[model samples]
Target chain A: MGGDFGPQVVVPAAVEAAREGIAIALVGDEAVVNAELAGCDAEGLDIRVVHASQVVEMDDKPADALRRKKDSSIQVACRLVKDGEAHGVVSAGNSGATVACGMFVLGRIKGVQRPALAGILPTEKNPVVLIDVGANVDSKPQHLFQFGLMADVFARDVLGLDKPSVGILSIGEEEGKGNAAVREAFDLLKKSQLRFIGNVEGRDIFTGEVDIVVCDGFVGNVALKLSEGLATSLGRILKDELKSSWLSKLGTLLSMRAFKRFRKVTDYAEYGGAPLLGLKDIVLVAHGKSNQLAMVNCIRMAATSVRNRAHEHLVEKLADHQGLNGKSEKSAA
Target chain B: MGGDFGPQVVVPAAVEAAREGIAIALVGDEAVVNAELAGCDAEGLDIRVVHASQVVEMDDKPADALRRKKDSSIQVACRLVKDGEAHGVVSAGNSGATVACGMFVLGRIKGVQRPALAGILPTEKNPVVLIDVGANVDSKPQHLFQFGLMADVFARDVLGLDKPSVGILSIGEEEGKGNAAVREAFDLLKKSQLRFIGNVEGRDIFTGEVDIVVCDGFVGNVALKLSEGLATSLGRILKDELKSSWLSKLGTLLSMRAFKRFRKVTDYAEYGGAPLLGLKDIVLVAHGKSNQLAMVNCIRMAATSVRNRAHEHLVEKLADHQGLNGKSEKSAA
Candidate 1:
């Protein structure tokens, strides 16, 4: 079973997805999956339960889980995609294991150097794609360029942007302002066919200045999680403030609609299921703490990706990516 | 001449700091400094103006500025410290140049591998020190370990934490979860005498779970700026919502005290200037966009560091650092 609540949360989410007319394969402990499924109204729904004997624990190492847990829920789910029984895989469980399963089991696209996780976050105007959030670390410049290429293709194909501007994340916005990898990656991106918009700082990630922000997995993951942490901490502070005074308490009720509107703009769950980019098959990683609603939204996103031929586009676009990045291809890796 | 509104901002701030009984030697172009100082109420204050011909533009490369701007204001300020004319240097100008000046002019403490910038950020409970916010990049394991060590001493001597808990920033809070350097640093930190709290994720930075979070300059800088950007963006969204309706306007007035308290907890300026640690003398780098109030606090913070003998503690503690980290020292660098 994957995620925090395993079958309990996932089953209801799958049922909801099925009701939304998306076919879902509930791959988990058969007994538990069945028990949870029995509680849902699943009449005439195209939802099937595939038994997975083992679970990938949150603390399990990706490599260890990949090697030892062949029958793990994440593995079985990925296997369904490889066998053509499923269009995509969605998991809220061990994210590292999900990524491992996606890479080792599902394999990589032909021209892909390293498959990465693209975290879609809401900005002021639109969704910004931050690639290589945590899929791989210690990335070479070539890998970062590929992450940019892959994310660019995703933004155009899935997000329906006509032309996506890409920016490599750095400490400063200047040409020679980043670490060795970023400095080199800047050159690679500058030579690429994608609408490369030089370097952007971490502050620029949430500014919606560019459609995609490319970084090595380590920094990207740190930035991603830091954003979430900051949001939570700020929310807690605001909540405490709103509750401190009787006048503010009255203000809270009157300002309820404003808060709701603010939530719609800031909620990461609103943009569900960040797809692991450059993979041969679709594998979406939901948050470890995702609820039933968030998971259902993730499943919906997975189905939408399949419908949009997101994987096929990545495969085809990477061929162009290689040719477009020919200048730095020799020096980047 | 370093940051925006150079003399205008720095002069008023220096005047304010001097009014508080802190001696300030303002290093800048003579005529401009004199003009700004003439406007300020500097009567009975310990403030002096030292003329420097050149100004280090914000976009100037650190190395370029170091080599070319020898007569720059920042350098003159650092030279003042080096000549023992001033106890410390405080600059709201070019940070990279400021770090370079701190390192080259004042020199590093014995056994210090690299000088770093330790940014002090406010959390709910206390201030957290994030080291190497933008001093250097492409950090080795030893560099990060040193950052942790330096920040630990900073927390103890300056922030008044008796035994500061230190954590290496990583994707996961496990021993072997980060990149190669972080994994190596994690082990090194574990072996040290400092209260090594194992690995901490980016989200833990604001939780006040640890007194110090150590990362490479690239990632640390990104994290620092991202926090500032997030606060601004979120504030914008909240303001837009609050102003949308009439009832929320009344609520905002009632919630004024709460918002003020929230700002107090979140203001980076409230913590004053971030010191450039590992230097022989105290050098504090304030925000480039620092207002008069912010810069005044920076000067006060610099004065406080000198009074606290922060440099003496770092030099003394690093000897213990070498011994405690004997297992990884040979391998870390």
Candidate 2:
């Protein structure tokens, strides 16, 4: 009942995940979800339906959604996590609302100053995590330093890295080439015990030179959206150019095998959803227009987060690192 | 002698521009410039060598470059324009050094508070201008508002757009979506008479939805470098994937023409160098690794700025718009 395709896509995806032996909870309007699930085998699987009386529109403000939509599917899904009925929550609904509900219901980790959204993007070498990718704008230096600590744990636990090299995103590779927030954050990052690689420019994100890139939510979000837009535009232009001539058409036909590999390497669907880190419970937010494959990947990601106990690792890592704010156990809210 | 290839690429490009009836000045160590000129028909062309005693290294700080390297080639080129010996200046040198030289030697135009660098990028629909790509990192709200005004004129006269719709880059497309700097800029843009299109996210930059996307230099620079890195990485991956199999290799051979066209469409050489806006005299800075084609385009862009009188138009436009800083005539230095 979330996203542009609503239950038409979500129902099929949830059914597929259920068949794969993952416990699934369909939290939405009963009648609407039932009508979509009529053709599926829901009885023999571990899928359960939990009705929610309200819905949060994609454009709904986070504050309004938290206050007005108490029985919204997003809120109900989060409540399930808080009540120990579900290990984690996955939503393709409005991200802002999801973040609000996650914060309001399950709360942040013990020492987390600000919970950040870790956007995992594909690179030539391996996937890299970009933290705070639209979660906390107008971020302070301490918040940014905290983001690096949380992401360092996330990259190791979720991404399965032995030691993730965390790099602060800035305009230049030098320590002195960033704005006020970045300059202060640089100092904090340098003092930490994590594999701090100093300042990295935007070019370093896709080169897979670092395992994690830390930035304020505003800049991180801009980089993510810009990459998406450029990749789509380039793919479209390349396809049109190939189809413009008969020779190129023949070439494209012969190279179909190679194109598949190329597409697989660049596709966002394979990366599933980004996780909201520094939270007490795992919450993954998929693209609003996610297809069945993306949804399945999201389910897999959520289950993996539960298995690894990523939040626990983040809590320990923060406690272990030098206190950037002079206190490690202080909660933001 | 500026850029990685220095006179090896710059000399040929100046010769090509000279043949096309554009007067060219090669500002560098006379011996090095003349050595490269020996490979061309410098005697028959309208090209002259202007000697500068020093060269500013790429890693030099902008302030240091301004204070120490008074006779640097970058400084000499701008001095040529300032002294009425040349109508415009083009340098494939260190961008920070170039910006400093342009500001110090040429100064800002009348009624301009802060000059910006416009990085024009190619999109599927058309080219869009990203203002202040690395000029003003800690930019004020008034600085961004002024950037929009300056970019509006730049798009109209240089980019050939008739009333380009200017959009403020933010996390969301909503009017209430950006950080503090962006939120304040939004109000100023709304009150202005220009074809302001409200807020646009990073996705809109490549979609060509807006003619000009305005942001502080830090964000703008990140977007620019991220795009460059992604394009290069994608290209490398696609090429490697194509060559991995015989079938794909044959296909690539057949689609060579289409691939060429695709490359041409996305190539930065065709777009030329980004202009340093609000300068009293026209100054263009090409990429540090600029080749002959990019240098030629930079020279052509410099000539275009002079013929279009972009600076004069900017002066009038700043005075005509609602006074963003209460006075546009204030200079930085």
Candidate 3:
């Protein structure tokens, strides 16, 4: 009901998670959800089925989903977290709708100005967290600073980094390398207590040297989408070239196992989903075409993020940093 | 003297170009240029050494390079084009210095708002041109429209794409998808006579469906650098995974021929250098770590661009389009 695979992938994944002693709620059309669940070993597992009357289509606008789809699975899941019935919510649905649900249903964190979406991209060294991947496109310098602060807290608390290095994504690494907004953001980040590594170019995103890369949503989204497009294009070209010749075809045959491992390492399914940070509750948005493996990992990520108390740490850290704290709810928006 | 590989890569490339009857001018410190040239089969080649007293370091600011390093290799090359001693200029030097030299030395074409650096990225399909890749950041809607105009001209004249479809790069493809600048630019592109394909997302860059993907310098630069970083990182990860086990390692050995073919197809050197479009004279900038192969391709690109008379076509087309024309030189800037 949520993803391209619908309840088929979601129910099996939920059943597996329940078997592992993780509490799970399947939020979708009850009839469809039960049909998919019937195929799984869900007997005596810690799982509950929650019904929602509407579905948010892939092409549906986020605003429309928020307004019309009040009884949508995504909204219900988010409401569950808001009501303290669930620690987190996971959706392999329309990311824009999921982001909207996170903000509109759950609301923003106490002092947060904008909730940033962190796209966790895996590198050879470690996974790099790129924040503001299209959550708030026209971001201000203060919003960028808040993004940095929240990402820093999330990196330390959820990602298990002791002291994560935050780098401002720009055209160049030089102090005055970027546009006005970036330069102003740099000045703010320099004064912050977070381990700001100064400006990092787009090339630095995959280096894995920096833990948290912060930017306005437009730039981050472009970087994320570009990586995805290129990776797919490159893989296609590599495979085409490998199969072009007899010698290469033989080599590909012998290397199938290695290729599988390489795919696993770079697969979006392995990473599961990206977390929408700066929200009051945890919300993870998986890819729309997420499979069973991806759904399972999405649940795992939600559990981990909830267990780590990322939102609480974010609140505490922001409160401790006087510059980011003490804003009234009215001023926060 | 320009790139990291310096005279070692540059001299041989120049000699090779000269061997093919492409008149080549080797610009750098005279002594170092001669020593490197001696290693080449330069017995009787159409090659001349142009001595420049200074070298623009990679970290040197563009303005500093323009004002202080007057006799630098990059400056000398652009000056050659300006003085009509050379048809075009090519340098595997600092890109900032290249763009600055192009603007200051060669000047911008009449009716052109800003000269953009078009980074030609190779894909499985036809090569796609991404314009304004760090030439002029904080660009206005007018500047972005100018980028599309210039890139469209370059694609047709140099890249040989007849009536190339130009798309404005943004976070989404919808007309109203992007930030303020992009939305404005979208309106402008639609009104213009160019083959505007509306807005394209980051994922569209590699599909090779669109000929030119235009954006402000900052966004374009991020897209370019991110692609380079991800391609390199992905290749490394794939190779590492292939060698992780003995079975896969054996496959890699068998697939060595196929791997070489794959590398060749995806090689950046094959594309040579990116042209700084909308300038009065052609100026191509190669990568900083460009080897001899890249240098050779840069020269080839420069020659092709010059032969196509891209600048003249750009000026004529821009002047014809009233939306861009009717501006004095002062107002244009």
Per lDDT, the best of the predicted structures is 2
Q: Is candidate 1 or candidate 3 better by lDDT?
A: 1
RMSD per candidate (Å) reads 1.9, 2.5, 2.7
Ranking by lDDT: 2, 1, 3
Per-model C-alpha lDDT, please?
0.86, 0.87, 0.85
TM-score of 2: 0.96
Q: Which ten residues in a row have the lowest lDDT in candidate 2 chain A?
A: A324-333
Report clash pairs, candidate 1: A3-A93
**Interface RMSD of the candidates, in order:** 1.0, 1.0, 1.6
State the lDDT of candidate 1 residue by residue for A1-333, as single tens digits.
677777788889899999988988999889988988899999899989899899999989899999999999999989999999999999999998898899999999887888999999988888899998998899989899989888987887778899999999999877888999999988878877889999899788887778999999999999999988888887788889899889888887878877786676667777877799888888999987778888888898788788999878877777776665565667763
Task: Point out the worst 10-residue segment of candidate 1 chain A by lDDT.
Answer: A324-333
- By DockQ, rank the candidates, best first: 2, 1, 3
Tens-place lDDT per residue, model 2, B170-238, is 999888888988898888888887799999998889987789999999999999999989888888888
lDDT of 2: 0.87
TM-score (0 to 1) for chain B of model 2: 0.95
Docking class of 2: high
> What value does the lDDT take at residue A217 in candidate 2?
96
Model 3 docking grade: medium
